[model samples]
Target: MSDSILFNVIPYAAALVTLAGGIARLTAKEPAAPPSPWTPAGRTVLAGASIVLFLHLVGLAAPRAMQVFNASPARLFTLESLGLIGALLLSWGLLTLGLRRAREGQWGAAVAFALVLSQVLTGVYVAVALRWASAWYLHVTVPYLRSLMSFQPDATLLQAAPLVIQVHVLASIALLGAAPFLRFGRVPARTPASVEPGLLATPREETP
Candidate 1:
């Protein structure tokens, strides 16, 4: 396969693995006092998500590099935007896992999850907004500003598209991060509360 195809496929596979593992854990029978922080299910999802997230970062950075090397503006914008969306979603998934762990009283694990999640969310927004601004700088705003350089422009209108994009990206990331945690972390401990005599009683045969 081509390098480009491999690059895209890797992240997708990682995401699928993470999602599958997470779903499995959610459906599995709850253990008393929550599963170990390093349980098989937890580790699988965490590792998968981390791999996917790293791939996403690489994907986002590539477009910026292409732009620096004089790649087509349209293609740059499209690639960057898609990368931003992917990164946002990955970060969101991570944060959600952290929140869920916290709710289950796994504070340390939750904190670690949250730290990475928050960083990814913040970075994705900032990077996407900057990328959008760069697009406007090369496309519309810079040209307009140059035209008005001689005349005193009454008011300046900067592109709000980038800011809006940033907000939406951040929101999306946060939501995705919160989803799994909310779904799985809320599961109560699966302790055997009480043993009833009836449950243990053997069936008795009736005599005529």
Candidate 2:
């Protein structure tokens, strides 16, 4: 019962919240302002996050291909190494962002940063502790996520996974649920090559 609630029920609930909140955010009227610029840390975070998200999506989209890709020992190690590097980069950016937010007295945003950082840390731990993450992810996480997408939630795929992995998955879902409500401030426009690093501060205006 508990497993069903946690894996099956919670994911759907979070998805609903994310869907509704996203629509509301899109439909709301707000004055447009000049796009702010991305800070160095923000760029770092975006780059790292994009890499990690891309890999995950690729795996989910082509589990069979990923399995074949990981069949070689060298290839598997290389893939895992890239994942760890991305995680490290993400951690570095989050640490910078969180500290800046704290210094600015944006406690809410800082707290959100902490939650996200924890999620990232847990993923790093999973990658390190559970060898061959990409291979196993295809077996466990991908199927489960696909199940959720197909409206056939199967908690069993995760029931046997390590507790940390389970926590990481659930925490990610929680973040998705809370995404719309998190007012972390507007992301600045893309930093141009000519922009001085010193001038690339986050926008002062917080998004409602």
Candidate 3:
């Protein structure tokens, strides 16, 4: 009972945090100076993440797709293999962006980068170690998520999952909580590379 509450409360709180942050970001004023344009590395990170994210959304909205893919071990292996590939790309992307953000003294981005990097690293671990989460997601996490959506969240199934899997869930909640504050999702414009003080900063930082 208590574990179920803990599981349910965490994600709801995270949702509120994410919502508030998103609103704040949207309403926030523009910065004075533009930052550096996004490097190819940064863009690559964003692109890979976006694809991975889209895949998740599609899976959630259309469980049948996953069911179709997971009907056989061979099929499930292919799906997990693709997920691993995406995770690796995301790691490379984060590394590329993290180095640049750190060098520019974008501490906020640096922090967000660390949080998400941790999540992705753990995600890779889950993919490698568990080896068939795509199918298990349907059997366990999906129902758990459904319960959360229905306002009667339950961790009953998850409580039985392995410790590393629990850690992955915690990391995911943390990432969701931090989402509203981070600029990782922001895309810089394709304007001229202006060193001007009034130009916008990198997507990770506010302009001067």
Instruction: Tell me the tens digit of each residue's lDDT in model 3 across 74-123.
Output: 87778787777877888888877777677777777777777788888887
| lDDT measured at residue 7 in model 2 versus the true structure, 0 to 100 | 93
Candidate 2 residue lDDT tens string, 10-92: 99999899999999999999787786778899888998898889889999999899898888999988999898889889989
TM-score of each: 0.40, 0.86, 0.79
Instruction: List RMSD in Å for every model shown.
Output: 16.2, 10.0, 9.6
Clashes of 2: 2
Clash count in backbone of candidate 3: 9
lDDT score, candidate 2 = 0.87
Per-model lDDT: 0.51, 0.87, 0.76
How do the residues 53-140 of candidate 1 rate in per-residue lDDT, one tens digit apiece? 5544443445456446436777666655555665556666666667678877978667666655665565465555455534543343
Candidate achieving the largest TM-score: 2
Query: Between which residue pairs do clashes occur in model 2?
Result: 36-188, 36-189
Q: CA shift at 125, candidate 3, in angstroms?
A: 0.4
Tell how far residue 198 is off in model 2, in angstroms: 28
| Candidates sorted by TM-score, best first | 2, 3, 1
Residue 19 local lDDT, model 2: 96
Segments of candidate 1 deviating more than 4 angstroms? 1-70, 132-197, 200-202, 206-208
